[model samples]
Target chain A: MLAIRRTAPDPDGRLTGIEIADRPAPPRPDGWTTVRLKSASVNHSDLAAVRGPGFEPGTHRVLGIDGAGLDEDGNEVIVYPIVSGPGYADPLYDPDLRALSQGLDGTWAEEVHVPRANLIPKPAGLSWDHAACLGTAWLTAYRMLFGRADLKPGETVLVQGAGGGVSTALISLGVAAGLRVWVTSRDPDRGERAVTELGAHAAFSPGARLPEQVDAAMDATGRATFAHSLRSVRTGGRLVTAGAVTGGTTDLDLADLFIRSISLHGSAMGSPTDLRNLARHCATGGARPKIDSTWPLHDAKPGIARALAGDQFGKIVLHCA
Target chain B: MLAIRRTAPDPDGRLTGIEIADRPAPPRPDGWTTVRLKSASVNHSDLAAVRGPGFEPGTHRVLGIDGAGLDEDGNEVIVYPIVSGPGYADPLYDPDLRALSQGLDGTWAEEVHVPRANLIPKPAGLSWDHAACLGTAWLTAYRMLFGRADLKPGETVLVQGAGGGVSTALISLGVAAGLRVWVTSRDPDRGERAVTELGAHAAFSPGARLPEQVDAAMDATGRATFAHSLRSVRTGGRLVTAGAVTGGTTDLDLADLFIRSISLHGSAMGSPTDLRNLARHCATGGARPKIDSTWPLHDAKPGIARALAGDQFGKIVLHCA
Candidate 1:
């Protein structure tokens, strides 16, 4: 099996950070099954996994959290990465929760093993690449908008950082779900393209005031956009966050929180049910994941470099099979 | 009307900061009515208004937010300090929301004028002091626990800063609602008394690790207890805050937030309905507001000093008739 493995952490900003290696096919643990990967998408978590402390030192680890593949019986499946605890109905409540590439080998390979429960059937209409994107970024955006923020249709939402995988997903999904989707970007070109390509209602420069406050604001670009995200929502509105790419630490004014009656919900990747619902929504609603660029499994360096530089607009995928 | 008024903002620490003045009674605005005061309670917000920035300078503003008095019809009423906009069912959702002492002249006088809608009938079984306590601190605590956190009975909650008015309310309300209430205080005596007198399940020193994580953690002491509050809740739990007496600014680790799936809710003094529910709960549930000490309105200096020093374990009341 051909796998893209992170041999060393990318501390010094080196390009070609990953190496393609011929590895043995993934061994299926009891109750788990091996899937031959058809497509996989890169996420910021994959970049973090490549950048150190996410995996042990001196150990070559396969890197990717989002993938769509086929089981031994030739059934197409979208892999849910979050491994749940026994008897817990919601994986979010599981204390010992671990996600793929965090604690287990992930889906950046020709063959990967995952729990049987983690497999959701990929719809016939959903393409392999779009199904692959559903595992991480799309699912996160889905949960942030629908599951965590609980936004109603016809309400407004602001997506900070319009060019990233999650922001693109939020804009498309929010628009598909009947939300007035606004976005912000550092680059005006990206902001304009976000409206034209991803169906955002409008786009603004970072920190530019919106004409009206939104019911909810999604922030994944943490420190850079945290204050804007907080200010963008209306009173009693929600500020939902999943990741902080620029940095984590941000100043929070407690008075603004209480006086405005804001609810800040912090979400991670999502529950398996959320992934299933996301797949179903994308399949039935005709919403598709935007792909930035794709590279064959043997030559994933350019895709890795593009993702690391954040130079692309959407999910960077690899044709793994 | 005899009122405790702050004649000037206190930029520097000043003792006996407020003056008891013989002033004209508040003129009732259209659609507003006068409430002849019976009892009023001091909150940290009152102290803030006296200090600076919270209130307009040099306006001789009355300095209390929580009060119980008699309406023009001689009906005993608890003043709901948060004024709501017309047609908005939830006052918290009102963009022009302003609480007593923030934008309006507050309670602390022999008589104060308020919107007629801001008065909830004081339950017959409730004491004037306890009813007064409901307008601010107790209501904030009630909303933080019940409305914001949505805590179920039998869930555990940690109240940070055990001696303040809100902490006392949370301890009593949480206990009365069948929650396992834990408290933390800098003073060992206060912590011990919180357990013995306030019916807390346990008490710990500030930042001390609890035996187990709580389902919800309430914080009003901002910088001093913010980190501890974040650390005290279990994954997928809530940290609800209403005020930040110690300081407003705090460092938030965004990674810890999303990874743990914590919800941070900021609740101000609750709605009129919450005040009514709190009064009814205290009346029927046999829960009484803990009054630390009382002073006649003529000699409110010591009470103000005690509250400013954070020396009291419960509400500081001004006996006005």
Candidate 2:
């Protein structure tokens, strides 16, 4: 089996290897299912794990979290990225799952074994590439809007940083949910495209004041746009976040938070329940995942590089076939 | 009539004056009651009005939110400081009520007018001083624990600071409600007193690591202890804050928040219903306010000075007689 494994943490992304690897196949546990990968998407997480804090030198760590493939009976399914406690004993901070990723192998491989509950049936109408994209970014955006923020239809959502995977997903999902969406981008062209193509009402500079305050603000830009996002929400509104990219450290104005009565909800990945809800929402909305570009499995480096550089607007997929 | 009026925002307590002021006796409006104040308590708001923000320099502003006084016919009543729209709205972000003190004359005076609905029957066994504390600090603490955090009995609550009125009230309320309360104070003596007198199990320095993480935390110290309070909660825990004394700016660690599954909830004073519930709790538990010192209505300066200096352990009261 060929897999992407990190033999050492490398800032240059050169130490990560994509090669034929041999291992004893995982024996199926009573409640687990082994899925053969048909396709998998390259997320920033995949690129980060190669060089970031988790990987130790000389240790083989399997890398992918988002994948779509087939079960033993040939039934298509979407793999939800989060692998936490069997039940909801606090999904975000389960120590067991935290230790496993640093210890166990992840998805970027020929076959991945996951608990039976981690697999959700892929809708017949959705393609493998679309299902793969749904696993992480889409589910995250879905949870941010509906699950955490509870952003209702006809409300406004200001998404900071226009061209990343989660921001793109937020725009599409926000529009589909009848929310008036706005985006912020450093590039005017990208901002315009995000507005015109993604159904956003307008786009502006990262911290430029909005025409009017929004009901909720989706912030993943971290330290850069956090204060602006806090300012963008109407009094008693919310700011929901999933990732803090550029930097995770930020200054919070406690006065703004308390005086305006704002809520700051920090989201990790989607929970199992949130994944199920996102799938159902996608099924109803007739929404298809947006693919920035797809690559054959052998040519995975470019897709990973594109995602790593934050150049792609939508998911970068690696087609296994 | 005598009143404590702030002519300007002055942190030195110099802008506040106890003066002989003249006004028409409050006439009962529809659904309103005119209470000839028997006693009213001093709060940080009074000091802030004298020295904080949003007040015109020449305009006289009466500054207190809580009072226990006699209504017409000498009926003892506890003044409910919350004035809302026709029905109960969520207190967290009611825009109409946010500008309350700025919009209306407050309670630190000889006579205070309140809506008839805002008066709760004073419990016979409760002292006027204790009842006076309930309107502002005690009510706010109750909402922070039960309404905002939904903290159940036996859960651990870490109070960031212990000498302020709300902190003292929280200590009493948490103990009454069966929660193990821990408090933090910079002064060793205050910490000892918090444990020995106020039922706090232990007390630590503002940012000192606790023996164990708490299920929920209450913070009003703002920039001074926000980071520590955020770190002190266990995963899936809550941080509820109502006021910020030192300052309102603080650095936030977004990664820590998401990784720990912590939620930051901002609380304002509270609703009328919250005040009623708090009074009932006090009535049941026989909890009395921690009065630092009381002054005759003629000389409220000393108490006001103690409040301004943050020198009091609990509430500073002004007695009308």
Highest TM-score against the true fold, candidate: 2
lDDT of each: 0.86, 0.77
| Residue pairs whose backbone atoms clash in candidate 1 | none
DockQ comparisons of all candidates to the true complex: 0.64, 0.51
Docking quality class, candidate 1: medium
Point to the candidate with the largest DockQ.
Answer: 1
Clashing pairs in 2: B9-B50, B9-B51, B10-B50, B10-B51
lDDT of 2 by residue, B88-133 (tens): 2464555676322455566677877778777787877788888888
iRMSD of prediction 2: 1.5
**What is the per-residue lDDT of model 1 for residues B121-153, given as tens digits with 9 covering 90 to 100?**
999999888888887778889999999999999
Worst 10 residues of 1 chain B by lDDT: B8-17
lDDT of 1 by residue, A1-321 (tens): 789887776675464456788977656678888888999998878877776555477667788888999987899998888887787647877889877777777888998888888888998889998898887778889999998899999999999988777888899899989999999998999999988987899999999989999999999999999999999999999999899889999999988998789999999778778888888888888789877889898898888888888898667889998
- Per-residue lDDT tens digits for candidate 2, residues A128-177, read 88887776778778878987788989889999887777888889888888
Candidate 1 lDDT score relative to the true structure: 0.86
